[model samples]
Target chain A: MAVASAVAYRPPRLARKRTRQAVLVWCFLAPSLAIFLLYRIIPLLWNVVLSFADWAPLRTIRWAGLDQYEEMLHDDVFWEALWNTLLFIASAPVGIVIALGLALLVSSEIRGRDVYRTIIFISYPLMTVAVAIIWRWLFDERVGLINYVARSLHLVDRPIQFLNSFVWALPSVIVANIWQMLGFYMIILLTGLQNIPPNLYEAAAIDGANARRRFWRITLPLLKPSLFLCIVIGMLNSFTSFDLVYVMTGGGPGRATELLVTYIYKLGFSQTRFDYAAAVTIVFFALLVAIAWMANRLSGGNAGAVETD
Target chain B: MHRYPRWPIHLVLVGVSFLMLIPFYWVLKTSVTGENIFAYPPSILPKSPHPFYYVDVWYYIPFARYFANSVAVSMIAVIANVVLNAMAGYALTRDFPAKAFVLLLFLSCMMVPFQATIIPAYLITGRLGLLDSYLGLALPQFSTIVCIFVFKASFDAVPRSLIDAARIDGLAEWRIVWKVMLPLAKGAIATNVILAFIWSWNNFLWPLIVTRSADMQTLPLGLARFLSYQEDTTGALYAFCIMVLAPGILLFLLAQKEFIRGLTSGATKG
Candidate 1:
C-alpha cells in the first residue's frame, strides 16, 4: 500500500511539472499578447464588424449590411481621397531611388562613411511629426531656408508656397517623405551590400566590367532582396502616412492632401460616421494586401531580371 | 568612377546631413529669436538667442507636466515591452505547443497596419476607461510585433546547452529563461529597449486619441498644439519647437550605435 501511494505521488508530480510549464509559458506571453489583441487585433476585427453596422456614440445602433460599401462606391470624396493616396504612394519610387543611391555611394571604401551613415540614420529614429514640423519651417513661404538658398543661387524666381499651394504641396510632402525615409532604406540596402562577398565585385572587375556595368550586374542582383523589402515597406508606409501630412498640410487647400487613412480618420472620428469609415478601412486593407502581393511577385522575379539584364 | 574624387562622395553625404540638420537649427534659431514670427522676413539667425521662450513654452502649456508624462509613459512601456517580448520570444523559439502558428499570428499582426484599427482601439480604450491615463497611452505600444521578431532571432543564437544544463540542475523553466537567456541577449535587449523607448516617446496617434486633456498630453502632442496655437513661426515658439525635440535628439546621439544597429539589423532580418 505504501509503494502504491508513492507511485501515485510520482505521476501527480509529473502532471504538476507539465502544468507549471504551461502556466509559465502563458505568463510570459500574456502581457504582450493581451495588449496586442486588445489594441491591435481586436480593433482590426471590430473594424470589419463595424463596417456592416451603423452606430455612433450615445445613439442607437443598427446593422446595415453593405450599405456603407454601396455609399462608398459613389462617394466623390472617397475617390478623391483614393487619388490623394495614390499620389502619396507614388513617393515610394523616390525612396527606392534615394536608398539605392545612398547604398551605392556608401558601399564604396571611403573615409567618414560611418559618420554619414550615423547622421542619416539619426533621422529614422526621430519622431516623424517632429521631422515634418522642421520641414514645414524650411518650406515656410516668407522666410524658409529652401527659398533663401535657392533664390540666392538664382534657382527660382519666387518663394514657393510649398505647403499651401496646390502645385507645390504634394511635391513638398513627397520630398519631405523621401528625406525622412532615405536613411532607413539606405541602412537596409547597406546591409544587403555587406552580405555580398567582395570576391564577386573583384571577379567582375577582373572581367573588365566598368563601374556602372558591374553595379547593374553584380550589385543589383545581389541587392534585390533588400530592394524588394524597401519597396514594399515604402509603399505601405507611404500609403498610410499620417503624421507628416497631418502636421504639414492637414490635407489642406480643401482636402488636396487627404490620403485614405486621413480620410478614414475624418469619417470616423471627426464626422462620427463609424460605418462609412469602417468601409474605407476595409478597402484600404484590400489595397494593401494586393499591393503587397504584387510587390512580392514583382520583386521575386527581379532576381531573374538581374541575371538576364 | 576614379575620375570623380572620393571626396565627392563624402561631400555629398556630409552636405545632405547638413541639410538634415537645417530644420533642427531653425528650431533653435526661432525659439530664441524673441521676435514675432509674422515679421515681414523671418530672421534666419536670431540676433539674440533668448532662453525665455523655453520658459514661456513651459509656463503657457504645462510643458513640464506633459514632458513628465511622456517620459513616464515611454520609459515604463519600453521596460515592459522589452521584458515581455524577450520572454515570449525565448519561449516561442525554445518551447511551445503550436509555435509556428503563434509566430505566424504575430507576423500577420505586423502586416495589419495601425490605420486599419485605430478607431476600434480607441473604442476599446474608452470602454475600459483607460483614456486619459498613462497606462492607456502605454499599453498598446507594449505589444510590438517587431520587438518579438527581433528578440526571437537573437534568442535562437543562444546555445541549447545552457537550457539543458539548467534543466539537469532542476531550475524551473521561468528561472532558466530569466537567469540563463537574458544575460546572454543583452545587445538585442538594449536594441529593443532603445527602439521601443524612441517609438513610445515619438508616438502621436494613440496619445492623441486616448488622452484628451492638455494635462495628459505627451511631449509631441503638446508641442504640436503649442505650434498650432502660435499659428505662425515666432522666434520664441520656434525655440520651443527645438527645445521639444532636444531630448529625443540627445538620446539618439547617445545611442546612435544601437539606433543604427536596431534600424538596419531588424529590417534585414525580418
Candidate 2:
C-alpha cells in the first residue's frame, strides 16, 4: 500500500512540467482576457442586443425588432449625417496630396530635412481640442489671422464666416483637419520614400527620365503602399471627426458639420433616446466595417495597419 | 537631381515649417494680449501680456481638479496597461497550443473601433455602477490591443535562452518575467506608457458621457466647457487652450524620438 501511494505521488516528470507551463500560461493570459472580454467583446455583443430593444422609457420596455432602424429611414437628419460623413471621407485626398508634396520636399537633398520633419509633425502630437481651438481663433471673423491676412492681401472683399456658414463650414473643418494630419502622412510617406532604391532613380536618370516623368512613373508607382496607407488612415480619421467638429463648430451653425458619431452622441446622451442611438450605432459600425473590408480587399492585403486608425 | 543646388528644397521646407508654426504663434499671441481681439490689424505680439489669466483660470473653473482627474486617469490606465499587456505579450511569445487563437482574438478586438463599442460600453458602465466614477472612465482604455502586440514583439526579440536559463537556475516564472523580461522591454514599455497617458489625458468622449458631476471633468471636458461658458473671454479661452495643450506638447518634445519610434514602429509591426 505504501509503495503504491509513492508511485501515485511521483507522477510523470514531463507531465508535471507541462501542467506547470499550462498554469503559467493561464496566469499570464487571465488579466488581459478578462479585461478584453468585459470591456470590448461583451460590450460589442451587447450593442447588437441593445439595437433591437426599446429601453428608452423603462415602463415601455419591449423588443422593437427593427423599429429603431425604420425610424432612421424616415429621419432626414440621419441621411444628412451620412452624407456629411461621406463628404468628410472625400476631403481626405486633399490632405494626402499636401502630405505627398511635403514628403517629396523633405526626402530631397534638403539641408534641414530633419528639422522640417520635426516641425511639420508637431501638431499631430498635440491635443485635438487644442488644435481645433487654435484654428477656431484663426477663423474668428473679427480678429482672425486668416481673414486678416486675406483682407490685407486683397484676396477677399469681406470677412468670410468660415465655421458659421453652411457652405464654408465643412471645407473649413477639412482644411484644419488636413493641416493637423499632414505631418503624420508626410512621415509615413517619407519612410516609403527612403525604402525606394536610389539606383532606380539613378537608372531612370540614365534613361533620360525628367523630374516630372520620374515622379509620375517611378515615384508614384513605387509609393503605392504608402499612398494606400495614407488613404485608409485619412478615411478613418475623417469619419471619426468628433473632437475637431465638436470644438470648432459643435456640428454647426446647423447640421452642416454634423457627423454620424456626433449625431449618435446627441441622440443617446442629449436626447436620451438610447434605443434609436443604438440602431444608428449598429448601422454606422456596419458601414465602417464594410469600408474597411473593401479597402483590405482592394489593397490586395499588402497594406497592413488595418485598424491603426 | 545633383545638377541643381539643394537650397531651393531647403527654402521650401523652411517656408512650410513657418506655415505650420503660424497657428501655434497665434494662440500664444492671443492668450497673452490684453487688447481687444477684434481690433483691426491684429498685433502679432501681445500688447501687454496678460499673465494673470493663466493663474485666474484655476479660480474661474475647477482647472486644478480637472488636471488632477486627467493625471489620475492616465496614471491608472498606464499602470494597468503595462502589467496586463506584458503578461499577455510574454505568454503569447512562449510555446502554447492556444497561441494562434488568442492572437487572433487580440487582432479582432483591435479592429473594433471605439465609435462602435462606445454606446454599449456606456450601458456597461451604468450596469457596473461605475458611470460617475473615475474607474468607469479609465476602464475601457485600461489595456489596449496595440500595446499587447508591442510587448509580444518586444519579448519575441528577447532570446528564449534567457528564459530557459532562468528556469534552470530555479527562478520562478513570475520572477523571470518581472526581473528578466521587463527590464529588456524598457523601450516598448516607455512607448506604451506615453501613448496610454496621451490617449487618456486627451480623451473627450468617454469622460464627457461618464462623469455626471461638474467636478469629475477631465482637462478636455473642462476646456470645452470653459470655451462655451465665457463666449467673449477670448484671452481666457486662449489661456486655457495653452494651459491644456502645454503638458502634452512638452512631453512629446522631450521624448520626440521615443514617440516617433512608438508611433511608426509599433504601428507598422501591428
Candidate 3:
C-alpha cells in the first residue's frame, strides 16, 4: 500500500508541474491580451451593437434598427464616398505595377542600386500629414513646382487648380497616395524577388526563354503572393488615408475626395452622430474583411501575415 | 546570363529617385528661402537661404510643447511594446492550452484596423478617464500585433538547448526570458523600438480625437493646425513640416537595415 501511494503521488506531482506552466504562460500573455481586448475586440463588438442603436455621448439610447443603414442607402454623399473609396482602391494596381518595375530595376545588378532604393523608400516613413502638406504646396496654382514646369513646357497656358477643381481633386489625391506608398510596394516586391530561387531563372535561360518570357513565366507566377500582399495593403491604406484627404482637400471641392473613412470621421466627431458613424464603421469593417477573405482565397490560402493557424 | 547595359537602368532609377526626392527638396528649398509662391521662375536654388524660418517655427505655436508631448507618448509606446510583446512572444514559444485560440485572437485583432474602431475606442478611452492625456494617445498602440509576432519569430530561432540549460539551472520562466531570451533577440528589439517610435510619433488620428486641449496636441496635430491657420502664405509652416519629419528621417537613415528587416519579416509572416 505504501509503494502504491508513492506511485500515485508521482502522477499528482506531474499534474502540478503542468498547471504551473500553464499559469506562467497566462501571466506572460495577460498584458498584451488585455490591451487587444480593450482596444480591438471590445471596440469591434461595440461598433456592431452601436450600429443598431441611436446613441450619442449625452443622448438617451434607443433602438434604431436599420435606420442608419437605410439613411446611408439614400445618402448621395455616402454613395459618392463609397465610389471614391473604390476608385482609390482601383488606383492601387497602378502603383503596384510601377513598384514592380522599380523592384525589377533595383534588384538588377547596377551601380548605386542600394542608394536608389533608400532614396525611394525614404518617403514612406514620414508623417502623412507632412506628405500631404508638401504635395498640397506642390500642386499650388500660383507657385507650385508642377505648375511652374507645366507652364514652362507649354503643357498648359494657365495654372491649374489641382486640389480645388472637382475633376482633378481625386486624381491629385491619388497621386499623392501613390507616391507615399510606392516605396513600400517596391520593398515588398523586392523581398519577394529576393526570395525566388535563382535556379528557376537559370533553367529558363537554358531553355532559351527571353527576358520578357522569363518574367512572364517564372517571375510573375512566383510574385503572386507579394502582389496580393500589396493589393491588400493598398486597400487598407486607401481606407486609412484620412489624414491625407483631410489635410489635402477636406474631401472637397464638394464630396469628390470624400472617402468612407473621412465620412465616418465627419459623422462621428465633427457632427456628433456616433450612431450613424457606427453604421458606416460596420460597413467599412465588413468591406475590409471581405477583401481580406477574397485575397486569402485568391492567394491559395497562404496569403502572407493573414493565416490563423 | 545576358548582361544588359546598366546605364539605362541607372538612368531610369535616377529619374525615379528624382521624382521621389523632388518633393523633399522643394519643401526644403521653400522652408529655407521663404520664396514667394507668386514669384515668377522660382529660383532653381535657394537664394540667400536663412535659418530664420526655422527659428520662427520654433517660437510660432508651442512647438516645444508639442515636441515634448510626442516624445513622451512615443517613449511610453516603445517601452510597453518591447516589454509586453517580448513576454507574449516568449509565452507563445511554449506549448500551452488554448494557445491556438490566443493566436487566432491576435490574428483577428490585426484585421481590426484602428481607423475602424475610433468611435468605440474614443468612448472606451473616455470611460477609462484617459482622454486628453498621453496614456490615451499611447494605449491603443501599446502592443502592435505585428511587433508581437516579430518577437515571436526571433525567440523561436533561439536554440532550444540554451533555454533548456537555463531551466535545468533552476531559473524561473520569467527570468529565463529576461536574462537568456532578450540577450539573443537584439535585432528584434531594434525592430520593435524603431517601428513603435515611428508609429507613435506619426499617429495623427488618435491624437486628434483624444486631445481636446491645445497643449496636449502632438507634432502632427500642430503641423496640421499650423497649415490650416497660415495656409501656404508662410515658410514657417514648411519649416514646421521639416521639423516634424526630421526625427523619423534621421531614425530611418540611421537604422534602415533593421527597419526594412522588421517590415519585411512582419509582412512575410503576417
Lowest summed lDDT across 10 adjacent residues in model 2 chain B is found at B261-270
Model 2 ranges off by over 4 Å: A1-11, A57-60, A197-218, A306-309
| TM-score, every prediction | 0.93, 0.94, 0.97
Residues A31-137 of candidate 3: C-alpha lDDT, one tens digit per residue: 99999999999999999999999998888999999999999999999999999998998899999999999999999988889999999999999999999999998
| lDDT by residue for model 2 (A162-269), tens | 989999998889889998999989988887788788899899999999999999998988787777778877888887878999999999988999999999999988
Instruction: Give candidate 3 regions above 4 Å deviation.
Output: A1-11, A306-309
lDDT of 3 by residue, B184-243 (tens): 999999999999999999889999999999989999999999988988988999999998
- Which candidate order results from sorting by lDDT in descending order? 3, 2, 1
Question: Any residue pairs clashing in model 2, and if so which?
Answer: none
Residue pairs clashing in model 1 are B30-B235, B30-B239, B31-B238, B31-B239
TM-score of 2: 0.94
The pairs that clash in candidate 3 are A304-B270, A305-B270, A306-B270
Q: What lDDT tens digits, residue by residue, belong to model 1 across residues A30-110?
A: 777888788777988888888998888887878889999999999988998898888788778888888788888887889
